[model samples]
Target: MGFCVESARVMLIIFNFIFWLSGVALLGVGIWFLADKNIVSYLEVVNHNVPNAYINYAAYILIAFGALIFLIGFLGCCGAIRRSKCLIGFYLFFLVIIFAGELAAGIIVAIYRTEIEHSVDKELSNSIKMEYTFANESAITKSWDTVQVELKCCGGKGPDDYMNSKFTNMSGIIIPISCCVLSDTNNMVAKDKSQCMNKVPEYYHEEGCKKKLIEWVKSHSVILIGVGCGLAGLQIIGFIFGICLCRSFKYEEK
Candidate 1:
């Protein structure tokens, strides 16, 4: 039992580090996205659009993951410090809980990405049809329903329309700007004609879009600090406790 506990401590430390590093990297990426003006530029490099909503949501989740690691690490450290079998068992159980949370989060994100991908496909189709008739006035101003023809079309209006919808729903504070749309220039299929000429100026200066982007940044920041700081603190405390637990083991043997 002594050797087994010792070995578990060592393994736990290794796994804890792995979790911490991953959490940090994700947090950093989220911060960069929030600070940068042209998020699309960074996202383009990664072959993603980095939707405002996803960024906000993912940042919070990453923080939570980090906190879990920290808590488990701290608990393991405490168990080692006191050489308490009860604490050690508890630590292990908490680690399992963290693992389950990670798995669930992964599944949630996967489903979200799949849905978003489908939406993108639908958006691409609409963009293509719109592109073929670009110069035509009738073709230029597509209706809200016309935009919704794409699959997985959610509660939002258009792509930009979705932006407004997100703004309205974000944190229960609605900042309404009726005429907005998300550009499809980033679409994989109709990449060239993704930018609707009419929507370019609006993209840069639209109040609704700007407000939504700002809100995205704010909400994501809360998520990052809440999760990241909490996790880091937990890990440090856990490590200290683990050392004490380890010493206790030798004391008990003597």
Candidate 2:
């Protein structure tokens, strides 16, 4: 049995509403994440923590979600235009696929939360220790300053003067440094201009920062897992409802 014109029209409208809402939401989320403060510093400070992984994963997920939303919306629009329940059903099928993907990813994240937490903690603890140690050492501070000054003065000739140089020695090349590490003066100057050097060599050499980082990751794992599971469940409900709505339409036709 086919849908009565009025019922089909109403269903089509509802589908459009869902499509629009989902599409706009996805797009907004993607944009927000791209501009989010945490993501901006992702390359700088993200260690092995769940939060860091979440942030990175979330950014890409938002982008993927946005694209999926656009595709679903377009398919929904086409289904409406054709007045074909099969097409609409196909759309719902894809929705189910998306829901399944969410469920799987959420489960994986939850299952491995412990390992991720431990790794993150270690890296973070080490970073903190390096930072604190460097701060306490007066000699290291002076050397770093001298290096900075020299890097600035060398007419940008040294490695520090290179295009991606984060730290430069006096009249030498610039070196690249990681956000977690501080710039060092141990090497008088870098010979290679192309290589980007990490600034916090001492942080890598220490282990204290890693412990604190693990502590933080363990504390926050629950929230991330909860949200992931919640979103998956919600999507499944929506998918089931779509199927029921289809069935209802058929009954009305008979």
Candidate 3:
């Protein structure tokens, strides 16, 4: 019996350390996502178009929850090491709250996944039509160019999506050079000089950016869901260990 209690206490201590490290990682990711200049600028331009804009809110929540988790992990570690019933109880309370928050977030994402995709697609299309231009580059324009260049994609729906664009009409260019496939030897020169002026389908990416972007979002959302489930499972184990430790400590006192 004594051996079992000792083993449980050791496990609790190790779990708390891992939990603390996870909290730190989460905090760092949240900060990076919110503070990155390019991401911030892009989001600012589309903020009004995005529905509810809860993605930013989610980042804020992550930062706050990460801090709370770090504090709870510290308390849990001390509680396990010192066999303090009060601290262990407090840690359990906070763990339960974190679990509840994770559950709520998961539900919200599941419920509104379709609406979110629609909002993203619509805003992307609108941004491309209204704001995209190679000349007089703005943040939105830069963002689109970066996406096109990196993703090897054209306009939101297709190259023709830019048909109604003011830039296309004024400049008489069917697609930006960013959408073109430059040769290995002269990639930089071609991109810089707009050498791939040919608007033919053979010269540019055939697929659309909107579909690719949506697919990317969906893939990441799956990963996020998996991470959330893993965290919730960890919280459940932590709760069990906490209760066991608290009980063992009480039994010794009596």
Q: TM-score of each candidate?
A: 0.40, 0.50, 0.84
Which residue pairs collide, candidate 3? none
What 10-residue stretch in candidate 1 is worst by lDDT? 171-180
Per-residue alpha-carbon lDDT of model 1 for 1-254, expressed as tens digits?
Answer: 66655665665566556656655665565566555544532222112333434544554566566555566656665665555767776875675565555445445444544455444444433432232122223331232223222211222223343333333344232211113243442331222222322445433223222223233334544544455445445544544445545555656577
Candidate 3 lDDT over 163-205, as tens digits, reads 8787687677777766787554225334333445665556667
Q: Residue 74 CA error for candidate 2 (Å)?
A: 2.9
Best by TM-score: 3
What is the C-alpha RMSD, rounded to one decimal, of candidate 3? 3.1
The clash numbers for all candidates, in the given order, read 17, 27, 0
lDDT of each: 0.44, 0.46, 0.71
Q: Where is model 3 more than 4 Å wrong at Cα? A: 31-48, 183-195
For residue 174, model 3's alpha carbon misses the true position, in angstroms, by 2.2
- Global fold similarity of model 2 (TM-score): 0.50
Winning model by lDDT = 3
> Residue 157 error for model 1, in Å?
16
How many angstroms is residue 212 displaced in model 1 relative to the true structure, after the best TM-score fit? 22
Error of 2 at 227 (Å): 6.6
Report the candidate with higher lDDT, 1 versus 3. Answer: 3
Local lDDT at 236 for model 1: 49
lDDT of 2: 0.46
